[model samples]
Structures are given as C-alpha cells and as structure tokens.
Target: MQLPLFPLNLYLLPGGISKLRIFEPRYVRLVKLAMASDDGFGLCMEVNDNICHFGTRVIITDFDQMPDGFLGITIRAMDKFVINHQWQEEDGLRFAQTSVLPNWTPTEIKYIDRDLSQGLQMLFDEYPEHAAYYPQPDFEDMAWVCQRWLEILPLGTEQKQWFMSRNDHRAALSFLHSIIDEELKDK
Candidate 1:
C-alpha cells in the first residue's frame, strides 16, 4: 500500500469530493501520477512535523487549466487509510505506505442527530460554493453525516487524529455535539 502523499490541513472523507489548485512543481507531478493511475494518492493532515496517521485516498475525477494557467483538479475521496511509514523525494513530493481502513456501514440519521443534520443544510445554504462541489449528499447516512462534519470543523490536528484513529465514530459524534452547541450559543 504505497502511495504518493499530499500534506495539507484539508481532509476529505469517503464519498467526499474537493477541488485543488496545483501550482507547486512537486504537487503538480503528484497530481499527474494520481490522475494517471488507478491507485491514487493519500491526502494527509499536516500537524507541525508529523502528519496525522489517518488520511483519505483520492483519485482525480476531473481536471482543467485555470484561467491563470495553473492546473486545477477535482478529486473524489475513495476511502480512509492510516499511514504506516513515509518519506520525501529530493523535489519534496511526499510518499507513504498506508493501510486502507474499512468503510463505515451506513445507518439512518437518528433524531438525536438532527442538529448535526441541520448544521450541514445551513452550511450549504451559507456557502453555496461548498455546496456546488457535491452534486448529491447522502444525508440519510449517519456515517456520512459525521464524517462530513468532522472534515469541516476547525478541530486541532491532534484532536482530529485522535477521533479518526478509533474503530467507531462515537467520539467524533460527541465532539460534534460540543461544536454544534457552541455555534448554537452564539446565535
């Protein structure tokens, strides 16, 4: 499970899609490789010198040259993974050995999760640009709901890594409650 790595604070969950601008020479090469191969690269969350073990394996779904002439690409997150080892090339492109994690089974969005549910709808309404990336959202799935929220919330990298490392997502759900509650208090 060797992969090319791109370390950014951005995270994408399984079934998530995001657009990225490729200008750095190293990343440009990495994007090309991901696009050309069936196996795509890993998107790691960079926290200081250490990258979070949890990451998403992404494949380029679309590509274009931006008006400014830099490469623009839209990637779809295929699945989650944990990095086992890593290294960098002379040009600074990061690569790693990863273990692909199991996809969560979908569950009906429960009543207790309505706030998490509404928050996403409010988000899409407020940020139409973010809404435009995902053509259809699987809001019925609790796993989908939690993962999407986890990606958007401004949680610390260590906290994010801690939540992501667990086999189940109960911790993430509770974390979301605190965040959603904080937002509710402000309004």
Candidate 2:
C-alpha cells in the first residue's frame, strides 16, 4: 500500500492516542487528505533527519482546525509496516509503497521479567507528569511502549531510528531494558 508519510521525532504506541499540532503546509495537506479519505496516515520515525523504513499506519480519530492555520489531530495506531520503496514528490511530500507486518507474538512477552516490569513501573512512578502518558506495560503493549520510550529517552536519533525499525518485540524489550537500566544507574 502506498501511503503518505509523516516523519517526526516522536514515537507512537498502539492503543495510544497521539495529539499532533500540524502546522507545516505539507502535513496540513496530509491531514486534509486523511479527513477526506479514510482518516489514515503513516507515522514514521526519522533516521538522520530522514524517514526510516518502518512505520505505523494511523487513523485520525479527531481533528480540529486551529485559527492560527494549524490543525490539532488525534491519531490511533492500527498497523505496522515496512516501506518497500519511496518516491519524493515535487512538493516535498513522500509517497511510499509499504508492506504491513504481522502483529507481535506471545513468545516475545516471555522475555520481559519481573525486574524489568518493576523498573518500568518505578520509572513511570518517578515521573508523575509522564505517568498518565505511559501505556500499560504488557505483552500486547510492548511495541508501543518501546517506540514511545525510544522517542522520549535522551538517546541519539540513530538509536531511536533503530528501535523503531526493529520488528521483534523481544529484542525491542531487551534493548529498552538495557536503556532503562543505564538511565537508572546514572541517577
């Protein structure tokens, strides 16, 4: 499927709602297309300021046009996909042929131990302001949590891109644990 890409420095989790303030002309156009069509678009992470190969297909659940020529939109994640090919348009918008991937499996969840679970709970507890924003850490929730944490962590953009590109839920969770452990130790 060919979809319009919206590359950002943030991570979006499944079963999560991301409220975006779209001010750029191209993104505004993308929002309009989504509204007029199926209300779905791609939320992709950037690699060195470029869109990575993998991303999630999201639906615009709610949107309002701001008086300041921007759009406030809420997106719900629906599926994960890998960009098979990309084409750049004259207006700076990208069109990509994407291959949707299967859902994360149960075996991946087994890799998450009690220590990591408690650590995640503690991290959320420590950051009260970010608590509500944090999704429930579970097997079904790992993909989004991994993506979300990758975005919020003080890691390099390259690392964030790598995390987003990862498809194995277990590998992603393990990487997240290492990152969280390093963060906890530094504190």
Candidate 3:
C-alpha cells in the first residue's frame, strides 16, 4: 500500500499512541489528507536527513487545535511497514510504497516479565501526562509491554529497528530484562 510519510526521530509500534505537533506546511497538508482519507500516514525515522527503511502505519485517532497555534494530532499505530520506495512531492511531502510487516504475537507476561511491567507502571505513575495517553495499559501481554518499552527506551533508532524486525518478542524481552536489571542494579 502507499502512505504519506512523516519522518521523525521517534518510534511508535502497534497499539502505541503518540501525540504529534504538526507545524510545517508539508506535514499540515499530510494531516489534512490523512483526515480526509481512511488511510493514515507513515511515521518513519529521519536520521541525518534520510528516511529509515521501517515505519509504523498509523491513523489519526484524534485532533485538536492547540493553544500554541499548531495542529496537535493523536495517532495510534495500526501496524508496521517496510518502505519499499519513497519520493517527495513538489511541496516536500513524502510518499512511500510500503508493505505491512507482521506484528509480534501476543505472549502472556509471566513472572519473569514482572520487572519490565512494573518499571513501565512506575513510568506511568511518574508521568501522568504520558499515562494519559493509555488509560488502561495491557501489562499482562508481553508483546504489548515490550513494544511500549521499545517506544520509550533511549535506544538508538538502529537498535530499535533491529528489535522491530524480529519475528517474535523473545529477543526484545531478553534485552529489556538486561537493560531494566542493569538500571535496578545501579539503584
């Protein structure tokens, strides 16, 4: 499928919601087009002025005119996609030919996954603003938890892309465990 591309230095996986402030004329046009059509836009990572190979296929769930005079839109990721080809329009808006990537299967969060779950809970508790995005989080689903972690973690885009390319959640889960465990050790 083809999608309008919105490049940013952020990662949003399936089931994740993100608020974007659209100020540029090109992205404002992108938002307007997405609102009119059922197909949403592609949120791709822009590194060194280059678009990454992977992106999340997201739809605009909500929109509001912010007090700052920018368009604020809340987008929820529906799926992952691999960008096969992309080009910019005369207005600087980018369009991509993308193929949907399968999401990781939902796995039950076992006892071993508690640390990651609890750490996420702590994050939500500490940041009510962030918590507001997810009124009811799925802490029991390993894939959900790991994807959220992947979004919030300070990992490099290359590392995040590596995790997103995996066929399952095992590798991301193990990596999260190591990262969270190391943080706990420091405390």
Candidate 4:
C-alpha cells in the first residue's frame, strides 16, 4: 500500500507514544490527512540522509494547535511496515509505497528469575514516574517493554534501529538486559 512518509531521527517502538510538533507546512498537511484517514502515516528513520526501509504505522491520538503556528500532537505506534518504494512530489512531501509485515509471534522470554526481574525492577524503580508505564516482566510483554525502553532511553540511533529490526522477543529481551546492565554498571 502507498502511504506518506514522515522521516525522523528518532525511533518509535510499537505501543509507544510520540509527541510531534508539526510546524512545517508539509507536515501540517500530513497530520491533517492522517487525521482523516484510517491507516494513518508512516514514521521512518533517516539514516545517512536516506530513509530506513522499516517504519511504524502510527495513529494520532491528541492534537492541539499552538500559538506559534505549530501543531502539538501525540501519536501511538500501531504496527511495523516496510517501505517498498519512495518518491518525492514537486511540493516537497515524501510518498512511499509500503507493505505491512505479518505480525510475528513474539518469542517468550523467562523474566521470572528473581535475580533478573530484580535487576529490571531496580531499573524501573529508579524512575518512579515511568514505573507505571512499565509492563509486568513476562514472556508476552517483555519484548514490548524492551522496545519501549529502547525507544525512550538515551540510546544511539543505530542501536534503536537494530532493536526495531528485531522481531524475536527473547533476543530483544536479552539485548536489553545486557545494555541495561552495562549502563547500570557505568553509573
């Protein structure tokens, strides 16, 4: 399916929330269209001045027009998709033909180990405000939690991209555990 592209430097994981300030004229139009459409728009990553092949289909949840002529909006991540082809129109808006990937059964990870869970728990405990948003450590929700952390954490763009490309929850959970351990150690 052909869809409009909104490329950003940030990563947007599934089930995550992204707030965007839409000041650019093209993006303003994009937001309007997304609000009117059912499928919404694609949020792609820009790597080395090129749009990444994978992106998430996002749904606009909140929108308000600011006095500065920018739109303050929040969007929820819905699904992962791949850009099949891309082209630019004369008006400077990017258009892409995309294909949604079939949802994969997230590999189950054992987060029940008291030691592992405690380590993860401590990490979440450090940020009490974010604790509510943290999912219970389990096989089904672990990947989603890791992906959300990867998106919101102060990680490099390359690392974020790697996490997005990964579909296996077990692998993602393991990677996240290692990264979190390393970060905690450094601090």
Global lDDT of each candidate: 0.85, 0.70, 0.91, 0.72
- Indicate the TM-score of model 3: 0.95
Candidate 2, 30-91: lDDT as tens digits:
88777777737888878666788778888998788788877789787777788999877887
Better of 3 and 4 by lDDT: 3
Off by over 4 Å in 2: 66-69, 106-112, 125-148, 180-187
lDDT tens digits, residue span 3-109, model 1: 99989888787888899999999999998888778999998898676777799899998899999999998988988899889998999998999998887677788
lDDT for 104 (candidate 1):
68
Ranking by lDDT: 3, 1, 4, 2
Lowest-sum lDDT 10-residue window in model 4: 132-141
User: Residue 177 in candidate 1 has what lDDT?
Assistant: 88
Against the true structure, what is every candidate's RMSD?
Answer: 1.8, 3.5, 1.2, 3.4
Best by lDDT: 3
C-alpha TM-score for every candidate: 0.91, 0.74, 0.95, 0.80
What lDDT is obtained when candidate 4 is compared to the true structure? 0.72
Query: What residue pairs clash in candidate 2, if any at all?
Result: none
* Residue pairs in collision within model 1: none
Estimate, for each residue in 62-108, the C-alpha lDDT of model 3 and write its tens digit: 99999999999999999999999999999999999999999989999
